[model samples]
Target chain A: MLLNKIIREKINSKLMLTFTILSCLLVVLIFFGLYYKSSPLFTNNSIKDLLFSSEWFPLKGKFGLLPFISSTIWVTLISVIIAIPFSLLTAIYLTEYADKRFVRMINPLIDILAGLPSVIFGIWGVIMIVPFIKNHIAPALGISSGGYCLLAGGIVLAVMILPVIIHVVSEVFRAIPQDLKNASLSLGATQWQTIKYVVIRKSMPGIIAAIVLGLSRAFGETLAVLMVVGNVVKMPHSVFDPAYPLPALIANNYGEMLSIPLYDSALMFSALILFVIVLIFNVISRIILVRIERSLGIG
Target chain B: MDKRKIEESIFKILMRVATLSIVISLAVILISIIYKAIPVMNWGMISQTPQGGFYLGENGGVLNAILGSLYLATGATILALMLSFPIVFYINIYAKKGSWFVHTVRLCFDILWGIPSIVYGAFGFSIMILLGMRTSLFAGIIVIALVILPIIVRALDEVVRMIPQGLLDASYSLGATKTQTSVKIVTRQALPGLITAILIAFGRGIGDAAAVLFTTGYTDNVPTSLFDSAATLPLAIFFQLGSPVEAVQNRAFASALILTIIILSISILARYFSGKYNKFKV
Candidate 1:
């Protein structure tokens, strides 16, 4: 027994030591991966120009990533504009108005929606969604034919993100303690009034977190937007115009990186810029998520 | 009372409309994909390689991509599990206090989780490209493992941490070896959760397209080694959709359905594993 006890203690110590090493190794590797891959494009002078320059012409040796940035922002903005309403309305209905059984049914449906891969969604968009917009939605708005356009991409993105936002917001609403609901009801508040005045107020941080998460995801979304968004590098005149985002630019254009020094560097530079944007967005979302956890005492 | 009841009914109706539409849309999308896919699905699509366009339902299969996905994903899944469990165990067990080491590692995983898959793709691309490997099967395997590591770590961390400390103490007090306690007592307790973690990582790895799109250079031909170019199922769908042939379109739809079914099955199995494990503990 004494020998076994000593053996157990030794094993525990070894396990602890091993785990520590693994964590450090992975973190180091990730940073190394980023810095190592991005070194070619990160020289001090060109870094500034790549980030701040107004125009992006890789073929002419001008490689600013601003167009991809603005294009990403534009499509993301349009998507949030459409998705925010649908998600909020859906959240309110699910939490404040729907019956318990109905809520159960809808929640899993949303989970399944969330699990749907972006590639399948892209296929759906290219085949079914693009044509629908070209023949019906676009012309109805008096726009030129653009089955593949910013509007189509944004809408598909909105649909893809709706479940995530709705899931987060509804969870927030559900997390509000029953006592708060009872108190609101006892004060003679209507269901809507209770939800608005009490429930939403209490869950404000979570709602913000949900919004931030949605924005972060919308900004970072790739295949869905890449497949639908017409790969036009120019600025959009309307939602119907084609757009190319940073993700698409890197994904599609990077492979064609031979025989041109400027073009190859341009792809790497855009990748670096994308890294920065995603990092900032993730930080903001983390802040909001932390606040939600603190406010709800759930962290 | 009557007026209040009427107002309640109106609100209920509004809720019904919004909730029902969302549900209906989800169903419609699933049914639509299945409807498109089932008719075109055949054994040959699984066994054969693409000869021409599979859109009009007349071409070859997704043999290389299918085999590549399974082989690479299986490799990645195994690698991720080997890397994950030890880290998760160390973090949860040894780093209970707000120690600098533990805190930094935890933050690293958090940041890694949100880092875009494209960035991983970029990193993997440079390394692979430099190594004279552009779009090889090994590239897909490594990047997918890295991409899903954060999620697997998080899930496994939670699972391992939940193994009660008493069990550890009890085993030790009874004179068991440390390895015995860890491998036999704690890990046994964490079986269901570990399964959940693995399933989650496997699901993410198999479904990835964008991260691997450039790295796993498109290859219609079957790969004979980790160095060979390969297409995954998601790549198959994307390439097929863009092809001009009607046969390619049909194959794309069928492949999409197959992908959906694969994802759905993984999710279901994951849920069951998690739930059953938790239930068993209770």
Candidate 2:
């Protein structure tokens, strides 16, 4: 019986280890798979021209991704700029100032927002934000826009990522020992002073990691941004200008990629770019998060 | 001292405003969708498939998309569970504490969790091209399974990690092998979390649009087989909203309402069951 049990145990462990290794290898496979599919584009055009040039005409084989890349950057940057302050303040409020019952009430609301489908957000953007911008905000600012522009995409994305940022940042805040807050309080520091000097200082790395993760998420969002951001293939000089983000480009054009020469390859290349960028951001944030957890003795 | 007090009050108001804004946005989104959908939402909306000229504001419902999403999410959840259970079990039960392999696997999962679904869509499309396969429910299931695999594994791993080591030790002292102990003790302890994880993954799978957009070609009819094209609710909303007709746009809001209800209920169920089941855990 002992021998039989030992054999079974060995077999089970080996089987599970195999699955674990395979799962890890799957990520690498995705990278290589995307690269292989996009390799054809590299042969005909240099990476510099493909990424730098602004012209994009599939019929004549001119695929410049600068407009898409720039639009993605502008939209993501705008979202981060708008979202960081609001989310940070919200996190601070929930963690430091709010009562337990209040926080509990808000938590579920945040969960609902986070669980909401991106398509719903897209619809909400179309019906609400687009018209509000076109009819109200644009004219007030002495500018004219058709409602579908980079600003609309940024606003939609900011709302979408708010819950994510708040969740991470508040968790970090909660992880701080109560004794540390008490120590600051005992030093005659007001709540805001303690938060400004101690809580924010201690959680800076975590806050940054949360923002990076949020930015990564904003970069990859497709349908919502696709719906609001006018899919115009040009550089966006201002927030009210139309833009086509990288994920939107892939989502919009992949269905019709088969008719033109190397169209599939170009779209695949854009997907590859998104994949790499998200991977890098995720890795950077993971490193920071792990380090913070280790320093806090919670890992 | 007075200046510091004033500064504190000012910052407090700012934080309150920030929190209120987020809550207000959630309310706005929910209310707007509900308001727009109420007029169009009827028994027929959920009961029948699209008829001819349905996109042109003719009589029909999103029954095809509703059924397709159900079938797709269900299949993807099952597949993801199969794949995730083994990996999560290996990481928590079989691997040594702080093992390099465990660290690497966890890191990979974290990265996978962050990858955008659109990239997954493109990747799935490439896989289809390689296999010479057409867009079908099967392809969508495969792609969504990949999308949710990390979610299930990470959630399950978090629960499994919290299982008391003493429980496993006691089982081992009783001559229980690691396999026996894991299959019985660890799984039982993690059951609540596992269920919650599954529900969460299902919600994500069903609500997702980008990953399945290219993999599952939308159809007006409900798919009878895995090889048939499937129209998901998210895509239905997208396609319907794209129409310039008022009726078609209203249908999009109604579809969005249905999807929201499904997702919200799943999340609530996950939380409720997890709390109720936690009492059974030692």
Candidate 3:
């Protein structure tokens, strides 16, 4: 028994040490990748011009990324604006109003939706959303449409993120104590009133985390946004105007790296920016979510 | 009282409408893809590889892409499992639960999970350039494994965490070592969850295009070696859609149909297995 115990301890210690090293390696790889890949842009190009300037003519040695940055912010903001109200309502319906069978049915459906690929979303965006915008929304508003623009990308992103936001929000709502709702109901409050006052207020922190997560997803979304955003390197004047986000720019321009001197570096720098922003968002949301779960006193 | 009742009914209607929209959106996507893909999908499209001018709407199939995706996803899932299983097992068994080190590691994995797939592609591209390596099947496998590591680790961690503390104590009281308990007891308990995690990760890897965009350069030929450049279904659809030819565009829909069928089947199988496993749980 003693001999077996000592052998197990030895193996356990060795395996644990190895895994710890692997964890460290993951952090090193990400930081090193960003630093090493974007070095050319920092060394050769002026950081001020690369960030502040809006002109992005790679062949002419101009590598401005302001257009992509603003466009990313715009599309993400638009998507959040489009998704939040709908997600809130759906979450409320699921938690407060839906029957058990309905909840069970929709839960798996949501999982399947979540598992659907970004490419599938892109195809749907291209075939359905884009043409609908061009033929209906644009013409109604007296604007010429190419069927691919910020609006189309934003709408596609909104749909893709809806499942996530709904899932998170519903969980948060469900986490609120049953007694709270019963108390409100016993006081003559209606279902909506109880939910609006008790459920939504108590779950604010988790809902914020969910919104932040959705924003991060929208900001990082690639294939669907790339297909619909028109890949134009310009500041969009309106939702109907074509524009490029940072991910789309990196994806669309990476193939043409051989034609320009520092184009690859520029794209890498854009990717680094994306990585930093997404990492920050994820860390913030996770912290908030943990706090909320702790406060709920659930394991 | 009357005003409150009116407001409640109105809000209920709005909520129902919002909920219905979600179902409608999913239905529209599935229906439209099937409508367009069915006409172009056939045995020849599935069984044969692309011939000359496949992108130009000539006679050919996406066999190369299907096979390539299977190879890359399987390779990446296996590699990710090898890396993730040890890390997860260490955290759950070796380290003290709720310790600062374990928390930090979990946080790190969460951040890794959130990093954009495009960033992985860029990082992989740079690594390839620094090593003077061309895009190949191996590169895609590595990057996709990196992309899914957090997923597998977190998922398996959740499963391992569910192992009853009493069981571990029982094993220890029986004079069994920690390694024996972990390997014999914990692993047996986590087997079903581990399989589900692996399947979901494989699905994510197979469907991803961004992380493999630069790593796996497109080719119509099925890759026979790790170093060979290979095509994937997502990129295949992307390239096909880019062509102006009408027939080529239909092929893109057909490709999406095939990819969807693969993912849906995996999902259904996973659900079935998980259900079956639940029946056996202690």
Writing each residue's lDDT as its tens digit, candidate 3 over A1-299 gives 78767986897778776876676467568767877777877775688888888988888878899999999999999999999988999899998999999988887777888889999999999989999999999999999999899999999999989988998888888889999999999999988889889889988989999999999988998998999889887788999999899998888877898578988888888988888888889999999887877788964
lDDT, candidates in the order shown: 0.76, 0.93, 0.88
What value does DockQ give for candidate 2? 0.87
Candidate 3 residue lDDT tens string, B105-203: 888898888888989998899989989999999999999999998889888998989888999999999987777887899888988888889889999
Clashing pairs in 3: none
Clash pairs (backbone) in predicted model 2: none
The candidate with the higher lDDT, 1 or 3, is: 3
TM-score of 1: 0.89
Q: What TM-score quantifies how close candidate 3 is to the native fold?
A: 0.97
Kindly list the per-residue Cα lDDT of model 1 for residues A1-299, writing each as its tens digit: 77767776767777767755665575456556655655666563376677667577666767766667777888888888888877887898988776789777777678778778888778778767789999998888887767888887888788788897998898788778899999999998787668768988887877877776777677777888899998987866788888888888887776577666656656665666666666676666666665665577763
Q: Please give the lDDT score at residue B192 for candidate 2.
A: 95
What's the distance in Å from true for residue B101, model 3?
A: 1.1
Cα deviation of A90, candidate 2, in Å:
1.0
lDDT of 1 by residue, B124-167 (tens): 77677678866788878888888888888877766776777787
What would the TM-score be for candidate 2 when compared with the true structure?
A: 0.99
Identify the candidate with maximal TM-score: 2
After the best TM-score superposition of candidate 1, give how far the Cα of residue B35 lies from its true spot, in angstroms: 3.5
